[model samples]
Target chain A: MNSVIHEKYTVAQDDFANAGKASSHIKEHLKEIGVDPQVLRRIAVACYESEINLIIHAYGGDINMDVFDDGSIQLVFKDKGPGIDDIEKAMTPGFSTASEKARSMGFGAGMGLPNIKRVSDEFDIQSSPEGTTITLLFRESK
Target chain B: MKLHELFNELNWDNLTPDVSLDKDVEGVYCGDLLSWVMGNGLPNQVWITVQGHMNIIAVAGLREFSCIVIADNASIEDTVLQKATEEGIPVFASHLPVFESAKLLIEKGV
Candidate 1:
């Protein structure tokens, strides 16, 4: 039997108050499933970064997590609004599009995507004027 | 050094009676950026920064810092202070610049 584990979170723009709750819950779920600590930390970090990106940059969006039967997890983050115009520049280590309010909140450090990339085994970002979507994959360490 | 030592060394004039410098500081982190601190900070470290925003207070709480020192005579809004005080997180202020306070704290072994 194939089992698909699913989780979803609604992210809002500049909602620092609720930021990281999604990642915290995701980490907890992974922990309950006996995911490796190191891998769990990495996944949680990426999940948090993505969730914050949606809240800080995107008008709004949803982040979802899916665990497949084969011991792998995939994260999908989708946002709608003025999408990132230049993926190249956006992915750079110190680039940020965060508002002043977001910066004041300790986000907009310009490390969001880079941090996400660092944590996930495979990462992909697709954006346009209409929306942006980030897909991340982490393989279980056997 | 223990928190009480830093309290004495820094010569903080007013630590709320309810707030206690009651723990040992493992190290110190100085950054205004929240993500950078979260990414780099180890729990139990003292966070030294000029920010007095509610978000800063919240970050320290989530990160479980030893205590937070607002530098260069900076003080957070009353709301932030109230929240911090309620969380059992000590808040201190100094007229010294961040670099100077950081040096003093490190020199004093806090």
Candidate 2:
């Protein structure tokens, strides 16, 4: 089984109105494809968290979700926004660089990245002054 | 308990009339943070919150929560209500606070 399903979504900065549209669509697609319930929940949380990060923190970015036949799911979050200066500090819970607008929306509690990491089986982050890219991977049960 | 019973018991103003009430709520979760709820809210739970933004509907729908009760009489935005109707997720507004709503729901065996 070498089949692969890839979906792409474009995210705009401060686009709170349509922030979770992509994740919602992906959730529906995954449900239609018969993803495990627990796996679906993990993906849903990680995907939405990642999507909001792009909307609130990034200048702009795109989310790529790939589901392979080998029962592995990977979410690639690539952003062209200002790269994180301190990955360690950013990863800390309750540490936030979010703006007032984001805070007002009840997000930016600095739990987005941590929650995403907690939900995914594998997490990788590559950041620079130019941009940031995060990869989250999960394996579906046999 | 059935949504109608719980709604009547708690005096919740049904925000989405087009969506009927027949869900069996098994638990309750109170939180203002969307991500926190997204990661922890269990299915068939009635989510109590003060955040009435449009994205709340997305979170409730994604988690398949039995219903969403916006506490303290917080006004739900029109877009949020419309999406709730479209997604068939029952939503209600409670004049009481989150704690009161949770207490009432618990008494009602939700």
TM-score (0 to 1) of chain B for each candidate:
0.90, 0.94
Q: Find the candidate with the highest DockQ and give its number.
A: 2
Model 1 lDDT tens row, B1-110: 67787687668644344777787789999998877776666667989888877666556654668888888998678776776777678888878988998898878876
RMSD of each: 3.7, 1.5
Where model 2 places Cα greater than 4 Å from the true spot, the runs are: A1-3
- Per-model CA lDDT versus the true structure: 0.79, 0.88
Q: For every model in order, what is the number of clashing pairs?
A: 2, 0
lDDT of 2 at A102: 84
TM-score of chain B of 1: 0.90
Scored against the true structure, residue A23 in model 1 reaches a CA lDDT of 77
Give fnat (model 2): 0.58
Please provide, for model 2 over B1-110, each residue's C-alpha lDDT reduced to its tens digit, 9 standing for 90 to 100.
77777777666788899998988878999998787788788989999999989888878877889999999998779888998999899999999999998998888776
| A30-142 per-residue lDDT for model 2 (tens digits) | 99989998889888889999999999989979999888788888889999969999999998877899899788888887888888889899999999978999998888752
How much is the lDDT of residue B54 in candidate 1? 66
Candidate 2 chain A TM is 0.95
